[model samples]
Target: MDVEEENIESDASHNSNELGDTQRLHITKYPSQFRALANKFAHEKNLKDRRKLLEMYGNHLISFKRSILLNRKRWQQRYLRRQSFLRSVFMQQLLELETTFLELIPILNLNGMPSKNDLRINHSSDVCTPITRFYKDLLKLESDDWLAKFHMQKSTFDWLCGQLKENGQFLGKNSLMGKEPPYERQVALGLYAFATGIKYLEIARIFKITLRTTICRIMKSVAESIIKTFGDQYLYMPTSEEELDEIGEAFYSASKMPPVAIGVLGVCEVPAKQQVNSNSIESENSTIILQVLVDNNMIFRKVKLDTNQPSLFLEETNEITNLSPKLIKNQPVSRFIVTPDTYYPLRKSLMHKYHDPVEPHEYDFNEAVDHLFIFRDRALQRLFARWRILKCNGDIDLRTMEKVVLACCVLHNVIERNEKTFNEQWSKGPHSDNTKYTMSSRFKPVLNELHGKPHSWKADGASETRKLLGQAIYSTEM
Candidate 1:
């Protein structure tokens, strides 16, 4: 019975081993198939996850597209509303302009067109028009009163008219119309326009010009005539010894500062049109520099308009080199006594050198006097003040700007020469002198004298000149 049980147990173990071997054989023979099955299951799970992700992305894309369409629609609506508002504003402005035009039409008397004969007759009958009355008043007024009103004495005006006629053929008998506005009337219009800084339209209305263009043409012609006729004659540097002597004498009389051909040098900032090459729109509001030299009498002897700052011109011309002590001491000194405010090379011996006046005790008596002379001798400042009053209010082209400024300077000189008229007009003036003088803080520091340069001179001579002058003055005071 025990043997039988052992056989059974061996058979059972054999059966169990056979079963295990069969399972191992199956796994070894189909290894690739098992792996393929595992990979296939993993791929299916990955596809399911990808499908969920695609659905979520598709939903978001749809929402994004809808939002884009809504934004586009909103922007379109805003653009339409903006267009409608602009259109309404434009229409309102147009309606206002039309109303103004209609109001002016009746006043202008453009309802009915008159025949040429009737127009001529009416024009002749209206001989005592406002323009005519103004001309009559100008004629009746005295030289001082006329100068006060027009900025030119009657004699100077007549002389200018004569000069213009002789040199520029200005206001001569027009070949077609034979002097339409007449000589005196044309000159009066120009002078009045310049002195008052009036626009062409206002001048046209005052002069009874049918078109503003006519007044503009007349003013332009007059300015050109003035420039062509008198630019070289009046606005010139002293070339001859006699001329230099006269200018030096004038300077000495004014400030007791001898050998100064010109009293002051400065840059005047005048409003002008934007240059062609300038890209800045704000440059239209900026000013251009007008470099000028004036005598003791405030007459502009030299004028130059430059796009650069004033110091650049001084450097370019080597003005410091020209102002050597030897050259300054030579005949017809041609030296300019500028204020300490001027930008030039600082020479210790020069009377106009920088001096701090904060501590009066530290300054010499001569230095104090120099400061006083500089402050009081403001010929350039006065010239700029007059210019401010007479300058045109609107921006003018650069080409025309120089001519206009020159013409005004000539007029200023002419007006100044008539001292009696100028004093009377200035004292009993219809317009008050409202010009304010302000010193510019923008300036380059004084340059040092160049070494090993032939033009360079020691400041010793300048010091001696100042010392001698100071001693002379002190002796006279004593």
Candidate 2:
């Protein structure tokens, strides 16, 4: 025992000497120092009783907030899918046909010609368009697809078709040997033309009509039917006191025009098939002007088709003979404002935009008048947008332009009265970029060619009438 104690003391002395007496190899010699650390934990540990619902909801909200890019990508995917479906629908419909003549979407190509196909169909005598079969089952289409193609509801088309039979006097050949196309087919042909504005030949291909002239005849008949059936009710010039009062009231409601202010007038050019005289493809120089008057409701009161130059349609009519005096003379019972952009002939009892108005009242008056013109511009935009045939997409023939436009106007009024709604996406389409060219360059020439203001536009009297109307508009706004 004495020897062991002496050895331990010698070892400690040796270690202390070697490690400078401060360092020790057994650093964890005190195991009780770490007892509290073993008992306490830093992380959450109620594993059996804790709820994850709150965290799940927070994660969902974060995902929803950050999903805008994902939504856009999905929207694009859906649009592409719809387009692909439409293409397949038309292509498969044509491919199912027994002949090659109508196997392609002619309107998809330029000038109503189909593209080259490696698969050639042998020409045969049995080839005929399934127009009857196609027309008979149009109601089977889903409502969205129906509006996309026809620009109208199926019920509306049905009503028009029925009315046409009763009163439209649609010109058609009657024979014991062959059956005429049904009224539904005729209306379909015309409505399709108005909806698409594709070439007549392309229209023919779509309907599988062998002769392009048949398509024209069918379209003309439908136009005539529409004009004949509904023209008197919707397109008449208002000369009667009751009609004038209703129109004036509509204008007041629409643009805050004075009680006397009725019928906004404007001149617009629509795409016309190049005339035989036109050698230029520059569409700006080739368009034909359409002169029109509309009430506050954007309904056409007068449509003077092919008003190539200044229009005399109003003056030449017997109904408006007394209207001119009331408009230009001191009678405040009736008057109209010309479109702001036009150098309209001075004789039409028209009031031009403000030239130079004096004080604060005149400035306010000019603003009200500007709002009036904005309303008119919007009216015209809505009018033309409803009928794409007038927009030059359909390449309307010069001979049939009036009939087509008039028919469209009649249909527009009918639709407006019926309160039909359509998907706005249907109007998005490939319009010819060149069709956007304007003929506003010719307005100065219009004034030049007219020589001088007519007797109705006596300068002093016109000024008083303008001021009276301006004051009325300004007071209304105040």
Candidate 3:
């Protein structure tokens, strides 16, 4: 505005001059000659540095604002995601809760009815008449009839019942709607269960038990009692030298193998309850292997559940390791137990039949070994025969099965020790499979019966003791 006003004033002055001195004013024109002027501090060093600093500060401010905005956006997105996830979780939890309530509603007893019916407390069945009469006249039954039916001689049964009675278990407390069973009745019930493999209900029907659960309790209690009372005495591997020697001599007398052989090894797999396991698609269960060490008399010396792992007898408990090495026919020999070829890593303490015997002496050794395995197998078969309950496919829990099996083994030993006669006809009866076992009365194995399959296993140097044993047997035969 000032410069324009000045130019107007100058123009007016020049107009006046044109009127007066028009020629001079018209020819005169002037421009300033000083160097072009700009901001005096702009090119100063300090000002230049300050300008650069301001630019950096502006850039920093811009970045900070951008970062703040980005952070807000990030948090907003995270909040949305978290809200979605929580909503889904809340919905799922609510669904689960609803499902749980729905599941529980039916089972809830609003009307105050019973949650479960106790079959033991309220049984509808009555005692069968024949069973009542049979038990009443159990003593009047014949010796052979008793043996055939109960798998024990009358005297042996009486002896066992007496022993059980002394234990003073099975109070017959569960016997509802009928007379309480005595100790004898309890023993009879257990023996019947052991012999029949019959269901508790059917056994109840046959035995006249008013409450089948009473029969179950009677059997379970009796088995538990028998195991607790006589398990150690009846089913035990002898560790003492005297006891070992006696057992060894007895086994030697029967098999004519070697005097060092004390026990015969056998394994019987009893059907057990199928266990629900995460590992297997097929119902995860292994048959309860009753790994047994028995003497010549088919008496179980050692009984164990196969949970001890793969090796059958000596490897499990190391029982034979305790055996003081014995001399048979003036040759050094380890007092050992005989096992089948399937059991391996044969050491002095354990022996199996020769694998693929090539020599004549090998055949001879195999013959003698056959007798040992026959007795071992026969003992196991008789165990199955004597107590058919082991064959029952029905669900029997591990603990109960263990008790029942151990109880049967105890009874077997007691019968053997008492010289109880085992009737041949008993093993062929209803509960038993029609498998024929050789006569233990003679302690003899028929050669024609020796059809045992040979194993393809070749013994390594670890089984040197067993190889030496085969050589010694050959030497003894010579």
| Alpha-carbon local distance difference test for all models | 0.50, 0.57, 0.61
Over all chains combined, what TM-score does candidate 3 have? 0.62
lDDT of 1 by residue, 1-478 (tens): 2343344345444433433554334323332333344445446657876566556545544553454455456556666766766665565466457445433432122334434433322333212112134466567888657656565567777777777767764443331121244655677777777766646445544565544334555666777888888888777765555665676666555445444434455555565544322332121233556666666566767777654455422432344225433233343222444534455443322245334433322234335345344433355444443443334444355656656666777766666666523432332233334433322456454454445343332533544554444444344344
State residue 470's C-alpha deviation in candidate 3, in Å: 2.0
Top candidate (lDDT): 3
Pairs of residues clashing in candidate 2: 197-393, 197-394, 198-394
Candidate 3 C-alpha lDDT tens digits along 130-161: 21344667779897778667887787777777
Output candidate 2 Cα RMSD: 22.2
**lDDT value for candidate 2?**
0.57
Which prediction has more favorable lDDT, 1 or 2? 2
User: Which regions in candidate 1 have their CA more than 4 angstroms from the true location?
Assistant: 1-137, 142-145, 169-183, 210-214, 242-262, 273-283, 311-334, 339-342, 347-351, 357-392, 418-420, 423-439, 442-478
User: Order of all candidates by lDDT, from best down to worst?
Assistant: 3, 2, 1
TM values, all candidates: 0.57, 0.63, 0.62
Model 2 ranges off by over 4 Å: 1-127, 130-132, 169-181, 199-202, 240-243, 276-286, 312-333, 345-348, 420-422, 430-439, 443-456, 476-478
Q: Lowest summed lDDT over 10 consecutive residues: which window, candidate 3?
A: 29-38
Clash count in backbone of candidate 3: 0
